[model samples]
Target: MLVDGHHLLYRAHFGFPRRVTGSSGEDLTGLFGFVALLRKAHREHCPGQEVFVVFDAEDGAADRAENVPGYKAGRAGADHSPVVHLPAVKQALDAAGVRWLEQPGCEGDDVLATLAKLAVVTGREVLVFSGDRDLYGLLDGQRVRALNTQLPAGRQLVTAADVADRFGVHPVQWPDFRALTGDASDGIPGVAGVGPVTARQLLAGGRRLEDLPETASGRAGTGLARARAQWQEVLAWREALRLNAHVPVPDDLLTGRPTPGLVPAGQLLTEAGLW
Candidate 1:
């Protein structure tokens, strides 16, 4: 299983209260929740599966920002206290002997996407442990899926079918879907007057954003006329949402199999002096 480190770390830090702490009185919310999530994932999703965690560097999304100045700018303006717990989480991971990476100039999603693609090329099936909807674009259905342990409705194993079933689009078209809808979370202001239905309609029939403008139906689409007028921005958003499958991880790390960190998380926490 591949993990999105910041995604789960933030989820854990926020979902769990600040009530927990280590022997030294340092906050242990992230450590506790992250370990529990990983432990449960191992028990329920992959008892014998190897686990690899990918973390975002400080400027992981800089490349995207270069293309679009506002990319993820909201995050910079949001509360950053959660990142304080990253070190403790890493400590717990190390204590558990889990393998992880924090590649320079790469986001966790891209690294996970790259690894997932390579794993499939080697005929390996991968389950991604993340709640980031953006990762849905990586779903290959047969070989790739994202497992979320954070959902209150209960954990869900999301495949390409789930994306299609939920959004009327397949995994490959997920970038296009995001393009039309825009992700305010990332500060990608979508086309004006456009939402889900209109976006789906524009992207329907296996047509790309660039081609949609040339279609008679697209030129005459009833809703989101302003968005249609701003098709160039939607296309740009789609390209930004597209995952890069060539993030260049070390070949030595692709061992064709993952070696799970089976040491009980409780033991790891204790070893970290957090229990």
Candidate 2:
């Protein structure tokens, strides 16, 4: 299983009800919640699976921002307190003998995509733990699926079928789909007047933006017309959303061995003198 470090950390820090402080009164909720969530998921769903955690470097989104100046700019003012817990989280993971990574100039999603693709090439089924919809592009239904822990019991796994059923598009078309729909979470302001239904209609019959009819009528069609008017921007957005599966990663990332069971979060923290 591959874990998206920032995704889980942010969720744990914000979603956790109460604060957790260390002996020195430092906030430890981010660390505690991240470990707790990871432990619970590993124990319940993947007891014998190897776990790899991937984090984003400080300038992880640099390339994307070059293309779209406003990419993820909305998050500039968001709470960043959870990031302070990264060191503790990494320390705890190391103490438990878990392998984690944060490659320079790379986002966790790309790293996860690269590792997931590598694992699949070796015939190992992979589960990516992330709430970010961008990772939905990696779903293959059989070997690759996102572990949607936020979902209910049986519906936790997000397969390619789920993506198709939910978005009326294939996983491969995720970048295209998201480009048209405008991901507010990432500060992407999609073409004016285009919404989900319209985007789906424009992309019907498995057609990409390039394959859409040049001329059409009606509201959605009119939206498509507008999208076509600013064709270059839409195309750029799609390219930005596309995941790079060929990132260079260490060969020793996977040793075909199951990870030993992780020590409990509290116990590990206590041993590390953080709690």
The candidate scoring highest on lDDT is: 2
Query: Candidate 2 lDDT, tens digit per residue, 99-213?
Result: 9999999988899999999999999999999888999999997899999688899999899999889889999888888898898988788888888888888888899888888
lDDT of each: 0.79, 0.89
1-275 per-residue lDDT for model 1 (tens digits):
99999988788778865456766787777767788878878878887777888999998898898987799998877777778878777877777778889989998888999999888988889999988898998898669989986565453888888777778778888888787778888778887656777777777776666656544355336545666677677767887888998998897666646566456656777877757
Q: Which residue pairs of candidate 1 clash? A: none
Off by more than 4 A, model 2: none
lDDT of 2 at 14: 92
Residue pairs with colliding backbones in model 2 are none
TM-scores for candidates 1 onward, in order: 0.91, 0.97
Error of 1 at 267 (Å): 2.3
lDDT of 2: 0.89
Among all windows of ten consecutive residues in candidate 2, which has the lowest summed lDDT?
A: 212-221
What's the TM for model 2?
0.97
